[model samples]
Target: MKLDVTRRSREAMRAYLAEALDGCYEGEPTISPIEGGRAAAERQLSNFDVRRYASRNHVTRGHVSRMSPYIRHGVMTLREVRDAVFARFGRVGESIYKFVFELAWHQFWQEVYAGLGDEIYADIEDYKFPPPVWQETLPDDVARAETGLVCMDEALRELYATGYLHNHARMWFAAYLIHHRRVHWSVGERLFFAHLLDGNPPPNALSWQWVASTFSSKPYYFNRQNIEKYTDGTWCRQCTAACPFDQTYDALAGQLFGNA
Candidate 1:
């Protein structure tokens, strides 16, 4: 899988990139997998082409996430992913730039984990302070939250079927899950990462922490109006509704419930 990426798709991607790059970039590729981001970019750009790859090619949505499983396995490298796309459409210009930029985002997120290390696992600096003692078992409410009881509509249902959420939906969900539902971020993180196709450790975990006020940022807040407005009528579980993290979750769920 990884080899195919580096060899075939990468070759195509690079071919395109080489052309798009032209005299515009002489110094190097922005990153190199071998020497690190900067070096890798420079090295890969060394020999590139434009005409051969990017044009008239169909970069499938399936293709976008296909490599992720392999990437998780470590058998496939980011270099291969980049090369494949670039070699194919590097010359295609702006379109490929967006694609490449997304790939770069993947790289950037990985570095966030690498640089932050266990700190990614730590509690956020802001907020009133004691970490909520988590229960041994997740609450019944947690499962209901997934049932779309919180926000029932096409988009919420889509999350269940597709096992995915859009960027905005995800933030809203996370906000609802943490601040409104009153659930522990760790529980929410595990549930999400366990299911999401695009799950990456740092981003998944840390971002949840961010929503949970376990991160340094101010606690996120949303009412029903925000959900109704943004989802374009796709979902409408008012913020006033029950959430996994709401104060009620603390009162009624589990044996000890969470007041302990």
Candidate 2:
């Protein structure tokens, strides 16, 4: 089971895995361009400035730490990350709250899964919206990033090529699939599990349910303005597709949930 890294270049390692584990995986054989191992993890952590993170982490090209793969795989622990942040910035402040809350959020999902086990696969609560007429599978257009919506298409393409999507994009895609497209939350959850490098059931599945309004008080949907604000209009500027997200929140709510 040991990979002999002594002689292989990164590309060679990727090729080796693709050949060795062929048919064991889906899609093209790929490795994240993000490097692995403790040294790389330490370097990423060292470069992460909590100050910049607090202000920009929600945006498309934000100052995210890029430590997700490492933390997800245990190359870095949540405690280690928290301690690292605390060492640099004091634990008690608005600056650290968002970043810390993210860590805690992941941990909270883990705890929920631990307690509920396979029950997490079922609805934890009823949808806050009307009963959904749900599709059980990811659509071909979506799987291939041909949805014609720039944001969703780009997010899917990013996931296919790099095995990563920004958190904002993930939420948007989930909401789109579940609400706009009438696909089940589990369908998008499985799509993410199949592709995301940091895909872990507790957060991935639960977050999808939360967005689908099966595990939260309401569904989470976003408007074009919200996307433009967070992405700085990057996708919208180039996007020629008729935007499903162009409506106001009230309009979206009625359109998506009124008939439930």
Best by TM-score: 2
Total clashes for model 1: 37
Ten-residue stretch with the least lDDT total in model 1: 55-64
In model 2, residue pairs whose N, Cα or C atoms come closer than 3 Å (at least 3 residues apart or on different chains), thus clashing, are: 130-260
lDDT of 1 at 250: 25
lDDT of 1: 0.54
TM-score between candidate 2 and the true structure: 0.93
lDDT of 2 by residue, 1-260 (tens): 45677856887788888888988988778787888899999999999988877655455768887788898999999999999999988888876888998889989999999999988888899888777678998899998899999999998889888988888888999999988999989889888998888888889999999998888988999999999988889999999999999999999989999954
RMSD versus native structure for model 2? 2.1
C-alpha local distance difference test of each model: 0.54, 0.87
lDDT for residue 196 in candidate 1, whole number 0-100: 68
Clashes of each: 37, 1
Q: Candidate 2 — what's its lDDT?
A: 0.87
Per-model TM against the reference:
0.51, 0.93
